[model samples]
Target chain A: MSFSPLIVRLMETLRCLPGVGPKSAQRMAMHLLERDREGALALAETLQAAMEGVGRCKRCRTLTETELCAICSSHTRDQRLLCVVETPADVLAIEQAGSYRGYYFVLMGHLSPIDGIGPNDIGAPELLRLLDEIEAEEVILATNPTVEGEATAHYLADQVRRRGLKVSRIAHGVPLGGELEYVDGGTLAHAFAGRREVTA
Target chain B: MSFSPLIVRLMETLRCLPGVGPKSAQRMAMHLLERDREGALALAETLQAAMEGVGRCKRCRTLTETELCAICSSHTRDQRLLCVVETPADVLAIEQAGSYRGYYFVLMGHLSPIDGIGPNDIGAPELLRLLDEIEAEEVILATNPTVEGEATAHYLADQVRRRGLKVSRIAHGVPLGGELEYVDGGTLAHAFAGRREVTA
Candidate 1:
């Protein structure tokens, strides 16, 4: 029902994006071909360049154009404190917070046996290989607070504790500026359980 | 706060699409780079090919890879009944209805004086020239019901009527399956005013 095959292909290709649905894909195709062809061309070029060039950082599994990611290459970063997270996006999120100075180990996904995802599927073997090379004092479990994420964290903790390394989970608590009444029950319980002594 | 310049550029370029914000752009970039590199490459190729190859049909201004659009070139379509719409997306919508065998003249935009978009800006001159070549019996205005659309339709009607060609506007009414209570006042009024005699 599209105007042309190229147009239809463009629309279909756009639907591969994370959240773009059929309607939004149609709108995007129309808008690009009509008003922003130059921008669209730029997007295409950049997309191709990135897809061909970017690869996982050998050390941390974060996406990079080179063998190692910026954090992994930087000598100033704390090599002893490795942050374990589920994806490269978490690495970016932590970087934006401007607090963490450690290297990262990106799992890319959590252990999901039902979906056929195992420890090796999410780069746990790679992480283990790197851990053997680097003298790490502590490993931070920064995976998401989902059921699968918790399971992954427990598994990683078990593996890391076998090497006698310190393990710490990023605290689950009420978000800053969040109202207590509106917080979900699970999060509220986690916040209550993980409460620390009030400081002056 | 991203990993690499190319990745950042890809994310920024993706934001050019309508309704895509920073967060979604980030997610799209991550998803494409991490999970679907081949699909991302295909999308890039399709986008580039489409942007380069697709152009306005010489006859009716719809997008095409060739000189004439499919509808305009089709002998079965009612060439004498030309439908004017604000965008190629509208043409697709009409085509999807499985009705409207008439050709289309895509305006691409409407008159928006505040934004400096006028008659000429939206290819009014080209439309006028096409009108002279085609022996069209009627020109159907299917522009949106917005203020700008109404003004554009009125202006087009005035211009088309001077050629002694019949000009008709598509009816504005409560949408199919929309409740009367939820429908806007102006649309309800238009629906009431344009009411027709009941048929058996």
Candidate 2:
């Protein structure tokens, strides 16, 4: 016998979440139905509000309910130093690190020609327009180190150079606290190739 | 720098699902916002509907939108046999195995006095009332093998026996496909104690 129609539907709909499968969906649905109805209802309200209200920031393309995101609207952030990344989550990661003081432009996704995603698809034109409008002296390409991310950064770097603005890509090397024995060949090669001069 | 207020709220609310932590919550929020807004909205609607509409089945107490669950309402299931389980998920597991064709009575939770849960809290009185009203000649206790489950089954068995019904606890032993050498000592003892004579 199957679960009631509503229970089944809830389980099926829960699979839309990343990394959630049939078993996890069933467990989550049952957990909500059996234990935490209040939490489930609150989650529903928050999801609806976010999905309907959250939109891309007009300036940086990061997710925001208002016209501009927190960083874009802030007066303290260095607007002259702009950083570009792949997704909003990447922005959060940098923010949590508590080092970067510059504003960001979210690309949402990297270039994927095989999937038919182009410069226009990832809002490249909008990024370029922001470059022209802002007084940014430097643009940091903080996209991931994957092939597609590298290709997207290279393409954006060419565009930034055309406007005579300084452009730089984030370093790719061995991660901090990583053991050399466990480090992969490609990372080792990058680490060696990008080695910096030691200070006296 | 943090996510916009709405996005942060969405991420926090998404943690209500079982096994989801801060990192998973952030990934899910970004995934829904960046890649699948439609799926996010649909999940929200389904969560709301299920949270508000789904209720306990009047007969079996499994989750359902109607008075009786599918198994309880079915004409094909055995009315003279009743299986008592700790949760609705247990009923689903038994049903998915495709062996049992009897009606089920969900206790929602096992007896756990440490957590302040008592017989009345888990609907034990309702289960007894149902037993008195039904034509069930045999009752099966299919609660988990944990301590609370064993105690619950033993208590319910006494009540069923007082009413002159045959009640039996599901067996505990080494599981199928598990190696004998790898099985735990308690299971080995249970297997030895519950051994039956083979028919010639």
lDDT of 1: 0.79
Error of 2 at B124 (Å): 1.5
How does each model score on TM-score? 0.86, 0.87
lDDT of 2 by residue, B39-64 (tens): 99899999999999999999888889
| lDDT tens per residue, model 2, A1-200 | 67889999999999999999998998899899999999999999999999999998999998999998888989998877888888887776666655567889998888999999999988899999998898898888777777788799889988888888888775566464432223455654454345332211
Q: Report fnat for all candidates as fractions from 0 to 1.
A: 0.85, 0.91
lDDT of 2 at B22: 90
Candidate 1: residue B36 Cα off by (Å): 0.7
Please state how well chain A of candidate 1 matches the true chain A, as a TM-score: 0.85
- How well does candidate 1 reproduce the true complex, by DockQ? 0.68
Best by DockQ: 2
Candidate 2 chain B TM?
A: 0.86
Report the number of the highest-lDDT candidate. Answer: 2
Best model number under TM-score = 2
For model 1, state the Cα shift of residue B137 in Å: 2.0
**Model 2 residue B188 lDDT?**
45
